[model samples]
Target: MSGSEPAPVEDRRDSWEGPVPIPSGANETFWEATLEGELLYQRCEECGTSQLYPRAVCTGCGTTDPPFETSEGVGTVYSYTVCHVPGEPGFSDRTPYAVAAVALEEGPRLLALLDCDPEAVEVGMPLEVTFWQVSEEAAIPVFVPR
Candidate 1:
């Protein structure tokens, strides 16, 4: 509801070969927004809880199929871990990347790749979301310093 959707800068890395998200029933809107340069989350109308990795019902209120809201795409680092080993194929050369738990300003926490030097991040660092279009139907949110 607060984050604006801006055209994403293309991700330069060509070695990435993880997985691409295929939009489905519950999370289709989230993936759709990514292509348009926006990030989406579900907010419950009844209990007012905001969450990521979209779900069919409110985790707080248990209401069915909560609506989606756009994120301001800004957050703070909550925690992180640096990976020196390739966790999946096509990532062997990308050793020492940081994966972080980012706490969004709007109230949800999400785990995303931190697009920065592993040594450059720390708890509470400010971040902003940018999408990397992994496929024509999907993009993944990667964060960098705001």
Candidate 2:
């Protein structure tokens, strides 16, 4: 190694495929549940509003804190897009895949990969949560036709 040489850039694509932002103060339970193949969300006890990207405070009423519960892992495609371009690394082999924002029956929308034939997907299509183990501590939730 020399001062004139640049350091090799590290690759982090194997960990996550997109902007994987986990909201502060509210992801421990959700990530823990994912390890067990379950999905979870927070529901405001003060006001019956459910939300994704879990938060410590309720987005509706600004409550000090909110309660959380496990979800059934069932949802419907609220919206989607067929990606001709590889949005993230490690996904070039899976080109032309569908990414969707699915609205869960319990009432929170989550963005995830849609695991089905691209031609078979449509808005409002039934879906169920599926897990993709990306690391020892994280497993992403993808969706598949139900």
Candidate 3:
């Protein structure tokens, strides 16, 4: 799929036993966008640095409240790990999952769950974002093979 297309959405709310994100502060906007199947990153207009895990101050130039830009939702796997053990609560049943640091086409990288068979993942693998709705207000981004 092309970068401009909306990422696919999966309704996991009924089965989600994972930790749910509570949107607040700078994260409020990011989480809100996710509910609509958009992945957003902050871009500093002053220094042109893009960042994820939204913060009030820009990492590049100390600019306050950097403007957000929607990502193309396509990325490359920069790095990854396979979890044989549950690292977080409620993930015991989902052990042997993959987590990856995905480098988006828009410049920022996101650490997200790679929702695919662990044995199938590799560095430099092309991926696309998808959301798993865990709550009414938030959905976590998950990446899958493109």
Candidate 4:
């Protein structure tokens, strides 16, 4: 697993009203790693494919238990949307935020909140991962300009 130093962190546990993730099944390790300011993805040792949204079974090969890899936490914006209207619960106060599908350098894409003014985002903009510790069980990945 290749990684840089632990990324920046912003503790949102006290103020977060959003839906906190409850780690279960294969994603437990993924969520656990977030607290340490690390981004994890699954890479199939058998087929050499990388994927996000950790799963018990590998997507490329039917290999059970693909190994985990730590990301460098750097990526570029693949696509994005500026939401003027709140899309999820607890986000009403955060209307007009940018959400992006970030294409990680490690070859997996992750959907995350882009932590900046919505107007500042651009396609292909370079980003680095950050974590918002929303709960004791998990933290959510957020991105910002690199």
Candidate 5:
């Protein structure tokens, strides 16, 4: 190879050096509940559907707005995969971790990392929510075997 240098490129995704945007109206109650180590989700009063990544409207029904409620944080593995490739920057240290879509008892499915033995995870495995404080205002929810 010639004695040349490549230009430096910046990763914009990792540029989030500041606090994360708490997604306007959805996560207010969820974060509030997190302060007390509780997990929260949106429950549609109109259709009785519980959903996550909280939203202003129910996915099942076209309700103008929905209500927030605390979740039991207990769930079962709806689906999962062992991530051999790190999907995010901070997760490099946690390579080969298991990520799963857990269906909470209340009816919402949340995607989070499974903090247990990868070999122990199964489609119907019971799990519980746990939080890791990523920032002063954000605590990411992870799951462990129940």
Candidate 6:
């Protein structure tokens, strides 16, 4: 698929075992982009700050309805932790997974699953985005070392 198009969900059974992302309001476009293999963040037109967990108002300038922008899906690990305990249901089987706070190239920092051995990731490491489609309307962004 083209860069603008998301990779198709491989199978519906392999994503998160916890409560899935439900698209709502300002977050709806963000989730929709994931299905097409795109990552999105909201940018404040007034102050030029970009953010994630999409919001209706810009935190930077208090502007209502910031515009959505597509991310390049590239980032660097700012920090991370290995999860020995399941954070949610069905995650017990995924012990030793990594959860990372990544600083995207565009300036937004997002928390995402790291698709690599817990011992294999490091702060400042470069990463690229991949999606784990969990529901018809949402796909969780995961990262892999680049």
**All models: lDDT?**
0.85, 0.75, 0.92, 0.92, 0.71, 0.85
Q: List the residue pairs that clash in candidate 4.
A: none
| Number of colliding residue pairs in model 2 | 0
Write the residue-wise lDDT of candidate 3 on 26-125 in tens digits. 9999999998899999999999999998999999889999999998899999999999999899899998999999999889998999989999999999
Clashing pairs in 2: none
Q: What TM-score fits each model?
A: 0.92, 0.82, 0.96, 0.96, 0.81, 0.92
How many residue pairs collide in each prediction? 3, 0, 0, 0, 0, 2
lDDT of 4 by residue, 13-33 (tens): 999998899999999999999
Task: Give the poorly placed runs of model 5, Cα more than 4 Å off.
Answer: 1-23
For lDDT, candidate 1 versus 2, the one ahead is 1
Q: Higher-TM-score candidate among 1 and 2?
A: 1
Off by over 4 Å in 2: 1-24
Better of 4 and 5 by lDDT: 4
- Prediction 2 global C-alpha lDDT: 0.75
* Residue range with the least summed lDDT across 10 consecutive positions in model 3: 1-10
lDDT of 2 by residue, 28-60 (tens): 777666656777788998889899867778888
lDDT of 6 at 91: 80
Candidate 2 structure, TM-score to reference: 0.82
Model 4, 48: alpha-carbon shift in Å? 0.6
Residues 12-96 of candidate 6 have per-residue lDDT tens digits of 4465576688899889999988887888898898999899979989989899999998888888999999999988887898898
